[model samples]
Target: QDNAVPKQASGCVSCHSADGNPLVEGVPILSGQRSDYLEAALKAYREGRRTGGPADVMRFYTKELSDEDIKEISEWFAQN
Candidate 1:
């Protein structure tokens, strides 16, 4: 891991753009979304509140994130 990169930052850009737009179809666009909503959604995936299908990928990605990581990510996307 690079010392300068924020945790969880690299993982998102592949599917979700740096500006929070989803690169693929069927993926939600996170740009302009509420921070609280983003955080809650991430938390839901992390906590297994979402199930099956596309949610599986989210769960896998968010599982390693701490609460603060989620907050930072949510804020980043929300501002885009």
Candidate 2:
């Protein structure tokens, strides 16, 4: 598997580190997560179906992500 970080996740590493260990206090770890769950959560944020806490931030970040981007990002983080 191509384990290089996804280009689409460039902005994500600031809060959620490349290794999936988020440095931010409230950010959740993404490493080793199920790709399907990550994709679903990202889609929920993008579609405004999820809310509360950092949902707004997540929504903003995910707003411009295409389905393919989400898939790639999800897979990237899942494998980390």
Candidate 3:
């Protein structure tokens, strides 16, 4: 498969930055984080498993992400 970094991640590049560092305050940096951790967190956010604080915003953003989207994003950020 292509695995060339999904286009869906482009939208996240702004706030999270291309390297997973957040440009805005209170946002967590995803760079170098554990892939499993990032994947679980993204799944939690998409499934409404986490709430309050940043989870609210993430929930909105991840609501439309498919399983593959979450996997690609988590893997990409982890690599950074």
Candidate 4:
């Protein structure tokens, strides 16, 4: 791993951000969503109770996120 990348680089937004992966379709348009809801959904996905589609990719992603990170991403989407 490179020293320049932060430890939090495991986050989806770390690579799939607007400037990086804005082209991927059906990847939730996080912008303008409610923070609390987003946070709860992420938690659900992490716990395997909210499988998405047939593959449940969100579950894998959410599993890697900490509570603070989930809240931060949710809040970022909610505000911007």
Write down the lDDT of every candidate, Cα atoms only: 0.82, 0.90, 0.82, 0.64
Per-residue C-alpha lDDT of model 2 across residues 1-80, encoded as one tens digit per residue: 44777789988888998885698999999888899999999999999998888999999999999999999999998988
lDDT of 4 by residue, 1-80 (tens): 11232334345554345322344566666556688998888888888987647228777667778998888767666665
Clashes of each: 0, 0, 0, 0
Q: By TM-score, how accurate is candidate 4?
A: 0.66
What tens-digit string does per-residue lDDT give for candidate 1 at 1-80? 11233557678767876654678778888767899999999999999999999899989999999999999888877776
TM-score of 2: 0.91
**C-alpha lDDT of residue 27 in model 1:** 87
Off by over 4 Å in 3: 1-5
User: TM-score, each model?
Assistant: 0.85, 0.91, 0.84, 0.66
Number of clashing residue pairs, candidate 1: 0
- What is the alpha-carbon lDDT for the whole of candidate 1? 0.82
Model 2: lDDT of residue 37 = 99
Better of 2 and 3 by TM-score: 2
In what order do the candidates fall by TM-score, top score first? 2, 1, 3, 4
Error of 1 at 7 (Å): 3.8
Clashing pairs in 4: none
